[model samples]
Target: MASNYLLALYHKTLRLPFGRQIFSRMFASKAPYFKTIKPLITELRPGYCELKFKKRKAVANHIGTVHAIALCNGLEMAMGAVAEASIPKHLRWIPKGMQVEYTAKADSDIRITAEIPAEAWNIGDIAVAVNGYKADGTQVITGFITIYVSAKPKR
Candidate 1:
């Protein structure tokens, strides 16, 4: 089977000095909502994706911490990439819902992660585990996003 296009692009772009940023912006352009997080994608591959974003004013709350919504946006971004890279060639997916728990203050740059098991891909609600952590490794959020997966229609 052909390799996933998104995954391939990530690998190719990673060869450049600013490839991750280039790829991240390109990916966010596909769904503009994700652009708000200003993500720096650290890793992308089948079944997993990880990204980091700074706690800048745009993403900061009134108390000077990263906003919860920004974290959710990052989670969704990572989860979306995971689904696209992991699903079978003949299958497609859309996020049905998200459930996340905020645990600690995101006072610094945050790293977000999304992961799925090889066996979890199927024609149903597939839950991808996602998490957000501070630069120091303190987990600030943890939860999962549910994506509805189904067979693609024959063209």
Candidate 2:
């Protein structure tokens, strides 16, 4: 398979000083809503992605815990990164739906990781599992984002 341009760009940008910040800014320009969470992609590869973000007042809920929606946003971000790297360039993909469970409270910086099976490239819908954890290693949220992947229509 050919190398993914976005993944290549991420790898290249990650090596520069303050590259994470630059990458975040570029990503936010494409998806404005993702900027709200201030996510940093710590790892990205085919079938896997990991991201981290601080727990700030903006993302806090009524009781001062990370809001559920913020966690969901993080989950989606991770899933999108993995999908972009894993999917073949000849194919196209989009989020079909998401199912999530809030297992614990998030009161600290959060890390979200997502993964898909290596054989998931078969034409159809694929479910990528995403999990969020706090700094202390508690699993705070679990989710599966369904992505629809199909061969790009030929002109």
What is the C-alpha lDDT profile of model 1 across 10-80, one tens digit per residue?
88888898999999999988889999989988888888899999989999999999999999999999998
Candidate 2, residue 6: how far the Cα is off, in Å: 1.1
lDDT for each residue of candidate 2 in 55-90, tens digit (9 for 90 to 100): 999999999999999999999988987888788878
The C-alpha TM-scores of every prediction are 0.96, 0.95
Off by over 4 Å in 2: none
- Alpha-carbon RMSD to native, per candidate: 1.3, 1.5
Candidate 1, which ten residues in sequence have the lowest lDDT sum? 1-10
For candidate 2, the per-residue lDDT at 113 reads: 98
Judging by lDDT against the true structure, name the best candidate. Answer: 1
Per-residue lDDT of 138 in model 1: 98
